[model samples]
Target: FTPLLLENTQAYEAGKTGTEIPNVVHGVGVFSVIGGSGSTLGLIIAVLIFGKVQAERTVIGISIAPGLFEINEPVIFGIPIVMNPVYMLPFIAGPTILAAVSYILMDTGIIERVCLSAPWVTPPILYQFLATGGGIKAAVFTAIEIVGLTILWLPFVMISNKQNVSEE
Candidate 1:
């Protein structure tokens, strides 16, 4: 259902003719991809740097490739983010915050609103570029989103680090 974020991009356009939104609407399709995969990559790096748990490592290994293409099932299901309390907050909050930032950026004209609908399978930075009709600002915004999401994922990752070390 995450791919639905990339669907119906044009619905954001206030004017039907132009590729640009001209004005913000429902923030529909404003984000190129959901933040899950980005957070997953961030989690992977966080685990590698600070986590000692082999279980975390295994899940991270399983998640890396799919996370690249914006697929997050391995991380979501493997980490069991569905019902796990430790991972849930950041998992939900990071994307919500990023979406707000994205909406602000586009609304303020710092980044162009999405003009074209990119396939959900498109990679992160590249997806932003294509979604914005080759705008570098969108790509830059996506890079920033990745970094911020990574930071948001850190405390939770460190929690895992501590939890794992304790159980050992």
Candidate 2:
């Protein structure tokens, strides 16, 4: 993920245009809350697959917004998440499951959406605080999402490793 993001289009543009990665990428703003550009990219990819199409669409738009924290478009457009065979399985399956779970939780009042529209680039704690009205549950859920993304991404990692081995 680190290497990919480094070589990703946004990074490339920065290098080409002579802007730093910080500015070229989304998130990283002043007076912002709820930021995690990397994780949000992962989350959105996952959600795009699992969520109602509209949910995915909504996140995408928010990501494109200039001042909004979600700045997911850079990673989405830059890393070019879709084409990698390594990502296809996880990208499609992981978020669907996670997003569905989040949706269920929200629907049943296990969780609620944010009132503050925190930045997507914000750390999980801040995001949780802002999203959950300053409750610890949001942080807990964010941690769960991280763990879930790891678990969700494992199969792809394994497959990629196996493929590399076979190629050798």
Which stretches of model 1 miss by more than 4 angstroms? Answer: 1-20, 23-39
Q: Measured by TM-score, how close is model 2 to the native structure?
A: 0.51
Error of 1 at 2 (Å): 15
User: Candidate 2 at residue 127, lDDT?
Assistant: 68
Candidates' C-alpha lDDT: 0.67, 0.45
Candidate 2: which stretches are off by over 4 Å? 1-80, 165-168
The alpha-carbon RMSD values of the candidates against the true structure, listed in the order shown, are 4.3, 17.1
lDDT value for model 1: 0.67
lDDT of 1 by residue, 1-168 (tens): 233324435444444322344544433344623534335656665666766877878888877778877788888888667787888888767666777777777777787666676776777788878877677988887887777767777899888777777776
